[model samples]
Target: MLYGNRSTMSALSRMTEGNRLAQCFLFYGDKGLGKKTLAKWFAQRLLCSGTGEKPCGVCKNCRTVQKNVHPDVIWVPHSGKLQGFSVETVRDICSQAIVAPNSGDKKLYIFADCDRMDTRAQNILLKIIEEPPAFTYFIFTAGSRQTLLPTVISRLVPFAVSACTEDETLTALRELGWPDADAQEAVAAFHGNIGCCISFLEDDNVKLLVSLTKEVVRCIIDKREYDLLKVFFSVSNDRNSALWLLHDLEMVFRDAVTFRLGQDIPSISCDPVGAGMLAGKLSTAKGQYFHKCIGKAHDAIAANVNLQLVMSALCAELMSGK
Candidate 1:
């Protein structure tokens, strides 16, 4: 039952003590901030049949849910390929929500990545949230509240989750048995996102991220045209990782910009020496150009435009001038 940031744990514990069961709760935060994990924890508590403090993980209901074999708990995953929740998915959840729990006291429906729910799907969801079944409870997670329908957000109690502090992040990484140095670097790479830090520790993807960042800085300063597609392929082989890589690239460039603007060099996200070197090479005007290019890249990403075109434009700007 224990997961996520201390603040969120405190809030949930306080609410549990008050015995207030909210029909819906809006959990919003940056990626890797444990919103999904916290949602699962909340759902477990609601489904627990224990006598006290609810999520007695020992309870039969809690055990079934923990093993993901509970008939009463319905989990709807947002389809990453489609890039949004489908109407059918929403309808399915609605149908399941009305049914009484087969074993637990409440029927728990978890909508992961609710931000991916399109307008139509969101509207359908709003109707359900407005009048949830008496014994139903809902847990939804999103990257931002703006991605949700306004009506859906208005009816839900909101919880803002964020990355844990530096110490807590390190502790979480160590709990995963990550090496001290690797843990430190992962924390820096993820900007303290606990989930990302854990992933970086367990995966080979972080190596590509570090390599890509170094290449990007090299290409930026060389002011030479390079195979942008090759770089993209080398770093991001999938849509999900592509999004993370794009965001990480933006942050790397932002650190360079910060260093160029005469900020603390150690404050940069990448290797300090590399950051300072990149900063030293970037003139003020070029720094501004890079920053502008990053903004455009972000817009292209959000619009679901061609990633190649966005990368090409960014490369053109990045290689423009000394």
Candidate 2:
């Protein structure tokens, strides 16, 4: 069910076939790019007891791993309260890693969202990863390996999972029973991040955010700065929601730029009329300027700037560009 990353998958498939699979691998890239999925697939293949090309998909070991009941497979859980893997949890994993597998010859340990792990936790895990038992296999998934210690990164092979192509994303969405129009919209909004696309499709708040973004755009075009400020204030109390709205607004501007270019690209907004109106209002230069302002707002939010002040300034700047 994994889409894209053909070359990386091919290389991994070859490694497994040749029995040259490394003891540890670091899968890093954009979120929802299927790094964790690929790690699990590789682990299933490694543990499959079938005689044919590994996994076979029907073997008992593969089935158990698929159902997440495999005794030999260890999935390191993240602590939501800490927002990362705690040092205590990493220590427990190290203790578990030293033990022999219960059912298979090799034990596969998968750590997801590893970029959230602090240095202390990573260092503790690094010691085991450095001199892991012959029966142990480790896979770590992260948005970027740069967050990890250089010493830890040097001990493992790295695989970069890129986002899927537009066609691939559309196909996957359709396969999941999404309507053609809805799938196309999600693809445009998420830019082929399947995880984000799925989240957007399932969340009603995302629909509201898109609507709010369209309203903000309309306000900007009509020179309704006060109305725009009102809308911005409505979401100011919820930083996460406000940030998401800003992100959607950024995408709307991007779509306007695409529209001005006369390209037949998919649009983030479902309303063709509004898209046309916004596109007609923005010249290439203005579109670029607005996009830059939106990017600045995102940076300011990440820096923990005051929400009201940031939103007020952003609305003022956006209106000035009009």
Query: CA RMSD for every model?
Result: 3.4, 4.3
Q: Write the per-residue lDDT of candidate 1 for residues 256-277, one digit (tens) a residue.
A: 7788787763342544445667
Give the residue spans of candidate 2 off by over 4 A: 19-21, 80-82, 213-322
lDDT agreement with native, every candidate? 0.71, 0.82
User: How close is every model to the real structure, measured as TM-score?
Assistant: 0.83, 0.75
lDDT of 2 by residue, 161-248 (tens): 8888788899999999999999988887676678768877999887777778878888988999999999899888877778788877
Q: Residue 318 CA error for candidate 2 (Å)?
A: 6.8
